[model samples]
Target: MAVVIRTANWHSERSAIRSIRDAVFVREQKVPADLEWDTLEESARHFLVFKDGEAIGTGRLTADGKIGRLALIKSARGLGYGAKLLETICEHAQTLGHQRVYLHAQQQAQGFYSRAGFIVKGDIFSEANIPHIRMVRDLDFSSG
Candidate 1:
């Protein structure tokens, strides 16, 4: 399918990143614009997923090891691209000396993160009027 994942920053890939996020988080999920757009974009490392040379998904990892803003266009779901985006972000976090990575996963997507070795750490909380739970995964540094 010629899938590719590329590392990017806000200044370099803002439009592509925002397009996917807007489709998945804002337009599809109906999340508020104010809550979805944050100051973290300036510092967080971003990952963009492309299939057949077309941008389809994106995610970001913060300096503090928080992974968030993961979004995939509706047409791109269930094709395994999400997993690639997540693994890429986790690998980057490990390379940055992070011991673990955490994310506030939407309640329904908890199972998705769980399959990737994340475990729930706390009670469900509300964000942007959607239920979410904190999921964390420890990075294994011995492999690389």
Candidate 2:
């Protein structure tokens, strides 16, 4: 699988980004449309993962160092693509001079993020009607 990660422009790539998010969050997870689409898109740096030239996953890093809206189509999960996408986001955050990055991870996905160096920071809460927890990972700028 030739998987490639690319930085996407929100204006030109909104449809591609929305397709993955829609399939994973809206349709599969049943998250409400209103809550899934937020005002943050305009300012967030988006990423799209393509496997063999086909868009399969997406993620974002916000201006304030929050990573969110991570999603992958059902066909793309459990293959390490998510981790690669996340690392790409974190790398971008570091390049932007952020000392650390945080995210509100769905409860079930905590273990995934934990394995990638994020630690649970606080109590559980609800977002988009689903249980989530705050997770944070400090950026290491010691290396290239």
Candidate 3:
């Protein structure tokens, strides 16, 4: 099972990205429409994952060089797509010369982010009516 992670601007791939976000964040988790989207979307790098030529998942890297909106479809979970998405985001970050990357991860998914090399920091917070926490990853590979 090979996972392909690619990034494109909103206009080039808005529909596929929207479908993933809506399925994971809106209809599945009941995240309100207002909270599910933000101004960053327009300028962010939206990544999509395709398996066997079918769009399977998506995540976004913000204009300010942040990665947070990572949501894969339910059926796609546990298949390594999530980690591949994170890898894609980090690669984009490197291309933009951002060494520090952070995300507001939903509390329940903290372990997932942790396994992807994000270190949990600070206390829990709320986003879209769900508990979340701040996580950061330093991409300065030369240090370690």
Superposition TM-score, candidate 2 onto the true structure? 0.97
Writing each residue's lDDT as its tens digit, candidate 3 over 1-144 gives: 666778866887888888888988999999998888888888787888988777888888886667877887888899777887898888789889998899988999999989878998899987789998999998866665
Number of the predicted model whose lDDT against the real structure is largest: 2
* Residue-wise C-alpha lDDT for candidate 1, range 1-144, written one tens digit per residue: 799998977897799999999988999899999989998888889899988989899999988999999988888899888988899999899889999999999999999999999999999999999999999999995875
User: Across residues 57-142, which tens digit of lDDT does each residue of candidate 2 receive?
Assistant: 99999989999999988888999999999999998999989999999999999999999999999999998889999999999958
What's each prediction's clash count? 0, 0, 0
Deviation from truth (RMSD, Å), model 3: 1.5
Candidate 2 lDDT trough over 10 residues, lowest sum: 135-144
TM-score of each: 0.96, 0.97, 0.93
Local distance difference test scores for all models: 0.91, 0.94, 0.84
**Candidate 2 off by > 4 Å:** 141-144
lDDT of 1 at 97: 93
What is the Cα-based TM-score of model 1? 0.96
Q: What ranges in model 3 sit over 4 Å off?
A: 142-144
Cα RMSD (Å) between model 2 and the true structure? Answer: 1.2
